[model samples]
Target: MNPTSHHQGSQRCGLDALGQFDEIVDVRTPAEYADDHIPGALNAPVLSNEERVLIGTMYAQESPFKATRLGAALVARHIAEYLETIFADRPRGWRPLIYCWRGGKRSGSMTAWFNLIGWKARQLDGGYKTWRRHVIDTLAERPAGLDCVVLTGPTGSGKTRLLQSLGAAGAQILDLEGLARHRGSLLGALPDRPQPSQRGFESALLQAIEALDPARPVFVEAESRRIGQLSLPETLLRAMHAGRCVRVRAALPQRIAFLLQDYAHLFEAPDDFGRTLERLIGLHSRQTIRDWQALIAAGRRAELFQALVETHYDPAYRRSSDSHYAGLDQAMTFDYDPTADDGHAQARALIAQLRVPA
Candidate 1:
């Protein structure tokens, strides 16, 4: 086997270096890989879910020597199969970065085989644990010199639309709701897609944040700590809370019109919509929920949306902004017409308003 390559400090093995290899391989079990692995890393588990469990049980109930021998036999069989299939197509110069849970036996065994087969394979010094630490540390500390411009407004005010517009117009934006696969409300879950696991969400968040330039302001929507089931990183929340705010203002009628179109899927499944509204039972009166359900059943969508905005969303928005966001009363107001405007023009004007005076 070629000499094993190792990093001196796992923490110092920044993502930049990890990106150099042709492939990043996670040789842990499928379940472990599913929990979370390095972003873009491919799963090629040396020990499968069942095999890992069997090895563990043997290690505990029997002796380490017997467990090692059994694990070796299984691993050898798996590797031989892989070589004839997955690795068979690989060229001689192919290079891969391999890791298991703790950079232990599973990955080491694979690395040894790959090297013997004339491929350069480097083992991640501390494996997934190191990458996890990097993610936590990166999120815990806000990017240096980063300034945020948070878009604040009541539900259905088109904050998400305007945020998208700003990004297309060249402003850096962190689309938290998009990343979380959530709309950030009780009725926010998408009709077709499920929200990502919390770990998956964080991995995406870190990757998105890392891609932006810290010298420029990142436009983000004002949000509660939690989005659907995932919570924003604490440092990110604090940064947004301390950032300058812009309150998007849209007339109530326009907001109602926008919601009817934006949330058209909810109307398609009235039962699901009504069941979702039931989550607000403790927050609103029983009679109020009954009325909302009555409207859903009757297909009085516009009226239902209007009532929800006035009774539930608007009140909660005011309380959240008033408490969490500093300097909200003095925030710049962006009057929006979601019905007529496609947001590009508004985005340009908003950018002009945000420009610092020379």
Candidate 2:
């Protein structure tokens, strides 16, 4: 079921009606809000951190009635404060759509309060959940008429970093790894951090793409639909498969050094490193993986990287390359030691050339 419009007064704003709203605010808890939120939402929570806990504990351990009274008291206090301080002398017919975690009492109460003040306020029937689903559905599927430039390279080729650098050079680029927060690999997971729910990931991607100029070319890292724990939206995967690929080839030593430097935190946390290595091992044959594990046990990190690239990583690259349409990946080999200024200059020239038809 859709997450919007459960009540009569609530407005059902799907992807289409989202544009009509003047402001969208998320009033969920800070932890919930931080995981990922509406692209431009203001976080004005009704409950303070401790007050929410007090209410939750009441609901969980005591009784729903006790929790209800406590929640109502807090909500009323905050709502009045907001109306007086934030929404004072608001424009006529000031329509506001308010939402909390489940489109329940918190949002419903706000809707009624605003209605009493002559504002056409509505509760989000499904709250943030509906918006999250909308975001995932849109990004997972491809929209029409978007040309893509996919950056193809082995792990630690600095694809994510390069995308940012290219964006700095005024090239429209999509930094998918940054959005997912997974870095798109077994080693990509940061310590104690889980990837966003698939729905959250889609919302972020759609927001990013919409901000770019559709008429201009877009640069993104070439990746499979799945990036670590999360999966790409189906639409985006198809778009990438059909897009032109730019092969960014670097030397083995450079890639190893880059990984060590970029992922220094992984080394600091033994559990993250061990878990990442264990997962990678399951993807390969027992002997090959065991051999790699042996290198790690012996503390030969660089050698382990070189072996994986020559055996696993390089083979995967060749297979992906072979399946492309004719002349799909126009190769651009860079020096193992690319000065920052030179890399930017080369990337800019390539992007401009990509803007022109072959």
Candidate 3:
């Protein structure tokens, strides 16, 4: 028996054994892969999304024999295509780790084909499900060991930009918004980009945290549990809440100016902007909503934005920050001028401060 193929029940070997392979091949449908997969794994699906769905329906409504026949034929065709295109250039000694939704037929078929063709391939035991469980387990304990510094500020205070600047200045930073691909606010969604799946977000977060030094303080933005549709891991959220706090302070005018520049897409797409405001109808009066919509129509965005800051975001931010962030009132305050450059300079200064022992 092959030493690597230590198949006890369904799993080929331990999860840590994944690093031994030349490549990780995800044989699940594209949709499943997109939702979440092993990081750095190549997508060489043995079944398309529609095909998987159709086969599943047939298995339930028709007969297992019929479903198996169709699925086997489709899997064979996909593997043939992969050999012709993706695997055509692969050398004889290439070894791959193959996985699907659950180390089932999809991954098994791919691994069998690769092995039959003179290359050694192993199937991931329990597949993506096992990998996901490992992520969840790691995250549950990962944050407890890291020293964290939480950066706190209201909306449009340039927290995300400053995080980038700090990262450039050699500071360890966890950019939650960047990972989620959303700004963590009502109007925070990017125009063309969609947020990652919940599992994908967790996977990204786990990898980022693992890369950081546990001995040094890692800087991260203060956020509520959720960033758009993605929820922060509970252990990570607790770590941020317990960390030392640094507040980024800016005047209303500066914040508004930064927001205007940052959210320029809203002006370009008035209808979408108006639709976002519709979420606020329950909180604000209908007249107020209409008035804000009118500002978009009249191209008076600055005034409209100012009103949102004063009436909505500021109050909510203050209340949340005061309650959630420990020692927030006594946090080291870093102020900046109105421009983006000034925000970066502030980040550099903060980095300098962090270098000195408290």
Candidate 4:
């Protein structure tokens, strides 16, 4: 049975009406809020993790009446606290959009109270589940008239950095690696920052894609089906594969220099760096792994980076690019040196060239 609504004086709203509210409040537990929520929504959980668990256990082992009674007390206390603090200094005409797991009691309780207090608050009709569905569906369908200009090359080619330059010079881009918080590689994990949950990644992806103009070309780095723990939507992969291909080229010495500068953080954390190298054990011989670790121990950054590129990154990139991207042999070339000052100018030239035609 559908849960009864306590949202009085305000109607339940669909996803279409999301922009109508001044504020979006998520009333799920803190853990749920942390997992993923609306991009700009504020978390105003009605019940905490412990209290929610207690109430659920009571509902299963005891009676619904008892569970409801306990939940009501907890919800009342939380709402009272919010009124005194989080929602304290609100203006008379303020509005808020509230949601929970579904259009259920947790959010309804807050919505009812907000309306009674003279602030118009609306409950999301089907709650976050509705928005999640929209994210998935939108990502699965290719946007009409969308064109992707794919940047392809081996690692350390400054593709990501160049994409940023392109954006600075007024070109559309989708930085999948940036969104995933993973560098799209085994070693790409940021030491201090962790990757987002798959759902969170998709949410950000949809928002970024939606912000682009479909008539203009969208520049994106060539990638495999997956970026870290998140999988690229098949529709996006199709668009990327079918788009114009550009190979970013740089000399070997510059590539090594770029890697050294870009990944300087790894050098500071020796133990973690050593352990990360161990992941390549099966791919490389034990002796090769030992040599790489020794390089780390001796602080031989240049030789170590050079060996890694020649042995691992370059070969793998060749195989993947050949199989995944189209028209590589005939791809347009963009020379980029990370140490050079002409990057933005190069990006602008490429943009003009891309606008000319295939």
For this target, which candidate reaches the highest lDDT against the unseen true structure?
Answer: 4
Q: Clashes in each model (backbone N, CA, C under 3 Å)?
A: 0, 6, 1, 0
Q: lDDT value for candidate 3?
A: 0.85
| CA deviation > 4 Å runs, candidate 2 | 1-23, 29-36, 45-71, 77-97, 101-104, 112-126, 140-142, 191-193, 270-275, 282-299, 320-341, 355-358
Q: List residue ranges in candidate 1 displaced over 4 A.
A: 1-16, 356-358
Candidate 3 residue runs with Cα over 4 Å from true position: 1-11, 342-344, 356-358
Kindly list the per-residue Cα lDDT of model 3 for residues 150-213, writing each as its tens digit. Answer: 8788887878888888787778889999999999889989889999999999998888998988
TM-score for every candidate vs. truth?
0.90, 0.74, 0.93, 0.95
Clashing pairs in 2: 3-126, 140-233, 140-234, 140-235, 141-235, 142-235
Clashing pairs in 3: 11-125
User: What is the overall TM-score of model 3 with all chains considered together?
Assistant: 0.93
lDDT of model 3, residue 247: 81
lDDT of each residue in 1-358, candidate 1, tens digit only: 1222446533223344676689888889999988788889888888889999999999999888999999999888888998998778988899788888877888889888888888887787777877777788888885434588889989998999999988888889999999999999988998888988888889889999989888788899988889999988888888888889998999999999999999999988889888888989999988999999999999999999999999999988877744687857679999997776668888888999999221
lDDT of 2 by residue, 1-358 (tens): 3433234534434434555566676777777777777778766678877888999999999999989998999989988898888778678766666778877887778777777878776666577877776775656454445677777777767777677778878888888888888777656775666778766677777888778777777887887767787877666666666777776666667787877677667656544465466666656777776787777767777787788778877777777633552336455543323224466766666666666321
- Write the residue-wise lDDT of candidate 4 on 82-118 in tens digits: 9999999987888898999977999999999998898
* TM-score, candidate number 2: 0.74
**Candidate 4 ranges with C-alpha deviation above 4 Å:** 1-10, 143-145, 356-358
